[model samples]
Target: MISSNKLIAAISLAVVGGFVAEFAKPQMPEGSNPGYMTLISAAVGLCVGWRIMGPRAGRDSSIGLGMLGVVSLVFWGLAVFGTIEMLRLAMRRRFDEPVEALEMIVTIALKYGQYLAATPVYITLAVGIVISGYVTNFAYRRWG
Candidate 1:
């Protein structure tokens, strides 16, 4: 059993987490879309949450599900985008200067400070999902 307030808070945190990922994109590389990574991260969170919460529960569980869904989508999207970017960088054939590629990667990494900085937020989103589920469960059993 979950409570309405806990459910709402969970959903809100998940959505805000997704939005935060989007907002952090300007700090990413030029012509790179970080929406995918954010989506993926969110999705991962949601799936984990859903698995933990299970189905056939009350309306509060539904809220948890909703939050999980959104967050999972964001997480998956972000991961896909990140992987593609890495692949593109890896595929560069300018092998004439191996060090150049490595240097380029380092430079790119430095430029995307937001991407690095946002790791904590992404981690938090996942943690939040789990926390929300537990909180909802607690509320469902104890609050009412």
Candidate 2:
């Protein structure tokens, strides 16, 4: 079931994820170590691209799919990294209750969203998504 569209979308989103991680690094709070952030983001991107965006490439307008992909990527990335942060905080005894810890995941994700909104990360993501969508569509038309 492998296809050129899927491969291109995965790789394209992976690159977008790395760029977003790098762009967000400087905006992070001081002394925060973003260990493996880029790698993790890229992995998330690959999964989202292949699973979410790949199959829908040629089924709709490329621009529409690209917009959806950008939204999906950002949403998944925030959820994944926010949960990681919440877990890290929980391990450090930052939360007094399990429910509080769960709530903090959303809080942390919103905070991350604030950081993204304050930077050019969205622009990069949008552009990357659009280009990837078009490219994937092209591959589909050419190879399938």
Cα-based TM-score, every candidate: 0.38, 0.93
User: Per-residue lDDT of 68-144 in model 2, one digit per residue for the tens?
Assistant: 77788889999998999999998899988899999998999998887686447878977886898898788889985
Find the number of clashing residue pairs for candidate 1: 30
Q: Pick the candidate with the highest TM-score.
A: 2
lDDT of 1 by residue, 24-137 (tens): 666566896554656654554444344433342245564475455445544444454444455577687634566765556545544443464667656655565555555555
Residue 128 in candidate 2, Cα distance off native in Å: 1.0
| Residue 75 in model 1: lDDT | 47
Count of backbone clashes, every candidate in sequence: 30, 0
The per-residue C-alpha lDDT of model 1 at residue 140 equals 51
Q: Candidate 1: misplaced stretches above 4 Å? A: 1-13, 52-135, 139-144
Number of the top lDDT candidate: 2
What lDDT score goes with residue 56 in model 1? 20
Error of 1 at 85 (Å): 4.4
